[model samples]
Target: MNHASAFDMDAFRPHDHGRCRRAARAAAERECQARGLRLTPARAFVLDALLESHRAMTAYELLDRLREAGLGKQPPIVYRALDFLVANGFAHRVERLGAFVGCVHGADDHRAAFLVCRSCRQVAEAVLEAPPAALTAQAEATGFAVERVTVEAEGLCERCRADA
Candidate 1:
């Protein structure tokens, strides 16, 4: 499911986040139902936390939230939920930051590119229609099949630039 090829810059600007969060939640519910996956309370809570902001959150931060919400105090609790969310494509792990964020575009397994704000740590997701030609060629030369690709570009966002 290819969406608009344009880069998604919603995280850098102010918008109706309530609508975004609601839509993402609804999408997750529908996906889970279709896939026969159980969206347990703890998993739902973790998804909600990740969707609360575009900022990536570390597992420890999520664990803190879970503990405060009286969900579970153990590290494994959060890890398990994260594993489910990621495996089901409802969330993504930002490897550069060692954190997680909700799938703003829903769960289509689309190739993803991220624009990360170095100052505020906000991340904007974009759809990468295809891998770079050079990379593909290089991989072909080496007889390596490309399975997945995630691009992360770091820079200051509009607000951060203005402040600077």
Candidate 2:
């Protein structure tokens, strides 16, 4: 149940890692195609790396993978690819971790909450039926424009909690 390990799409457990990875890639390709966009090699590589693991990864960590793959050795290259992935809704930045994770469930722009395991730093994405009441009321009172909302709840997952 390591978050750094493969992710099981349906059960949220480890299973068919490669299949899930390919599905995510294919989904990204389809999304790009429908939008008249291209999933460039670098972007695809970064996304694939993220898809390979549920744990959030920093830019430098990804850059190392890119280097090993001969994609690019420069930090800017990785950053640019991340920018594209995040901007295009193929990925999301875990602000708390300052890292990135691939969007396997669907497009990134959707309103989804993030469950972050404090012990393992593994992130699980969850779709919220609606924005939290407090947040909505605060926004309304301030007349703040809300573009996208992602809630980050920190706690131990079942595996981690049990290990404790």
Candidate 3:
């Protein structure tokens, strides 16, 4: 997976998950409205499914859900929706797993860092105020223009650790 290190397991800690999902959905809706973006059926459904859990979900997994829901069986439908969501900051890709997660923080300025659960594969996003120092220095030294960056950490979550 694309990762720099491991992290604390605060994401797997208990809270009102249903409430969190609702809040996330509401935020997405608000952001879409503000930006004049379309929260299309396919895109909204995909976001809802991802937000149902903190886990990163593969395209195949999500495609199955879409098929069962009769949204669309074609891969392009989901792929296109994913493209829009990721481009608009409504969703993010967890490159390590080649999966996607709904962005709960709405469209914000912070860069996303993640604590990834290796067992369950649930990801909790952390906002970084700036790029990591090493990457910044490297880019500057090379005169390379950095457009985007994703920082991820992998390890077990509390539940997985307990299970072990």
Candidate 4:
């Protein structure tokens, strides 16, 4: 399986998961309405599955859940749902893990950093107010325009560390 970097691992951990999930879904619904986007059944189900757990889920894993829920057992169904969620900013793709996670923040494609637990593969996201001045300056000096940045840190979570 793909692994996030050590820095990304710091973000994912136990917390008020229930509240987080509910809040994320509510925010997504509102954002969809505001943008004239429909939170269709498949998309909603995919988002709910992601929100229900902190762990990043692979497309296949999500398909299993969709199958159990009688949404659709086919791969295309889950893939299409995931694509819509990610495209709309309601979810994010964890490139390192090749999995998906529900965005805790609303549908804004701001610069986000991630902490991922290697053991459990849970992810937590944080928004960067601005790019580091040093990095920005360096890019400017090189006549390069900084467009996007993805910072991922990976490590063992407290529970995993404790178990070790």
Candidate 5:
């Protein structure tokens, strides 16, 4: 994450989740239109499911949702949707949890850092301006091209901490 900037993640605080979900959908529509990408019903549904909360959800969980919605019963249905979403920067995969979350920020490609709650499994997303200096240095030394990075810090969220 960008250490120089101040950021408040709504996931860590109370906010109008309805408004956030609607805005994310609208942004996805606009982005798809601009990019000439097809936002299929299944894709939209998967995105909506991910945006419904800050918690990371596994593919099987998402597939269950799809099945309940009568979208698809097969695994490939959700997997393809996830593939498109991750490819277009509309969603992020939480490696630690082996799950996924919708991107809060718009479709613009940006580095993301996450604060993951160990107790509740909620994830707060933050933008990183660039790769960390130490990591970049190590990669350069090894002649490794760093294509992507997933930074996740695990701990308790405020609500969970207070409850404890």
Candidate 6:
């Protein structure tokens, strides 16, 4: 599947969560094997937890899930898994909220932009081909080499706006 073009928001809501989780796990496994990376038990479990929900989750929230699953009841366990996932491009950290969200776009390196729903904490991610021209130009003018960029926009989602 073309990860970038295949993304559909409707598929993420109130559907077969089990299938979604499985597909994500399978994708990760395949990608890891292709890249010679080890997807340890803890890493897999944490990835599964994030994939199970489209909503972004804090590290503490992920720790609770790890505890429930008998993975390990320590903060370092979750952090390590998170670090590995983020470093490998399997996950992205929402700097605005200090939380993590799985990369639904498979495990490829791409610029990420997020539409964050503040009220419900739902996060939708899109893979960007390049940094915004404005940002690029500004960086060039300042002689700053831009490596990676994360653009996040925060607002209430449709449901939240309607509720208000």
| Highest TM-score scorer | 1
Winning candidate number (lDDT): 1
Candidate 2 displacement at residue 146 in angstroms: 4.4
TM-score, every prediction: 0.93, 0.83, 0.88, 0.83, 0.92, 0.87
TM-score of candidate 6 versus the correct structure, residues matched by position: 0.87
**Tens-digit per-residue lDDT, 1-164, candidate 2:** 11222233332356676776677788888889889877889988999899887888999999999999998899999999999988887888887788888877666455556777777777887656667777777998999977666677777788777799
- Per-candidate Cα RMSD to the true structure, in Å, reads 2.3, 5.2, 3.6, 4.9, 1.7, 3.3
Model 6 worst lDDT window (10 residues):
1-10
Candidate 1: tens digits of C-alpha lDDT, residues 1-164: 23326666889899898888998899999999998999999999999999998988999999999999999999999999999999988898888888998988877667777888888888988777887778878999999998876688889999999999
Candidate 1 residue runs with Cα over 4 Å from true position: 1-4
For residues 39-139, write the lDDT of model 6, one tens digit per residue. Answer: 99999888988887778899999999989988899999999999999998888899888899888777777767777878777787777677788888899
lDDT of 4: 0.80
Query: Which is superior by TM-score, 2 or 6?
Result: 6
For all candidates in order, the CA lDDT equals 0.88, 0.77, 0.82, 0.80, 0.86, 0.81
Candidate 5 lDDT, 14-103, residue by residue in tens: 899888778778888899999999999999999999999888899999999999999989999999999999888889898989999988
Root-mean-square deviation of Cα positions for candidate 1 versus the true structure, in angstroms: 2.3
Model 3 spans > 4 angstroms off: 1-10
TM-score of 4: 0.83
What local lDDT score does residue 149 receive in model 1, on the 0 to 100 scale? 68
